[model samples]
Target: MQINQLTRAYRYDGIDLPIPPHLAGDPQALRAYHATLYPAILNAEAIDVGVAGTVHVTEYRRAVGTKG
Candidate 1:
């Protein structure tokens, strides 16, 4: 017997944010909620997990620029 796990997270401002349980199933809704907290997420990169290993991962990467 084998089992697979699915994980989703948001990377914003160099931090990993966990998705709210209520919005975990709905990507669009999750985005809306997250956008409210971090407006930059509105332009975040949504990456879906490709088939490779047992644990599947979905990541939302928000490109935050640094002041130099």
Candidate 2:
């Protein structure tokens, strides 16, 4: 299935933030909006997970090691 046709969601803090229609194809916009709700997202990176049942899942991973 095409990416635009597949469902979109963001996984963070063990919760799934389903991407709304307005922010569907805009990764940066989605991140910005999600960051407002979860400040930790600012430091996190988006990790794309292969399609699952036609849904595109992206996980937000935060830095765990000591910052140098």
Candidate 3:
């Protein structure tokens, strides 16, 4: 997928593309994944995951935007 296309898709559907599995459990892994995946997703990136707790979308949205 091209970057522009991905951005348009995101704008319409609010879906961020995922990071690959090999990069899922590490901080640098997400950065590495971003290096590869961002071009395909127009610079969309994943934030660091919480290691000590579960993520709640409701709480997240109240704190941040819907893009997570």
Candidate 4:
């Protein structure tokens, strides 16, 4: 899946993937989009770990953010 940073949207095989407007520039949105496309991109050359499913944005912020 390829994401157009400017639009904060994704596309697979030239087909555009629908993502919410609020999620623009947010990593969590990226993760959710990734999960939905996993089955198709499983054989892709490179996919990062920890991006396996449609996890909520808040959870991601808590898990990855620094309290300081």
Cα-based TM-score, every candidate: 0.60, 0.81, 0.30, 0.34
Worst 10 residues of 3 by lDDT: 4-13
Report the CA-based lDDT of candidate 3 relative to the real structure: 0.35
Residue-pair clash count for candidate 4: 0
What shift in Å separates residue 25 of candidate 4 from its native position after superposition? 1.8
Model 2 residue 49 distance off true place after TM-score fit, in angstroms: 1.3
lDDT of 2 by residue, 1-68 (tens): 65457777789978998677888788899999899989999999899877888687899999789878
> Which residue pairs clash within candidate 2?
none
Q: For residues 1-68, what per-residue lDDT tens digits would candidate 1 score against the true structure?
A: 97777565555565666688989889899888878888877887877645445544555676669857
Query: Relative to the unseen true structure, what is the Cα RMSD of model 3?
Result: 14.1
Ranking by TM-score: 2, 1, 4, 3
Residue 55: error of model 1 in Å?
5.4
Q: What is the C-alpha RMSD of each candidate to the true structure, in Å?
A: 4.4, 2.9, 14.1, 13.8
- TM-score between candidate 4 and the true structure: 0.34
Candidate 3 global TM-score: 0.30
Cand. 2 TM to true fold: 0.81
Better of 2 and 3 by lDDT: 2
lDDT of each: 0.71, 0.86, 0.35, 0.43
Worst 10 residues of 4 by lDDT: 55-64
lDDT of 3 at 54: 32
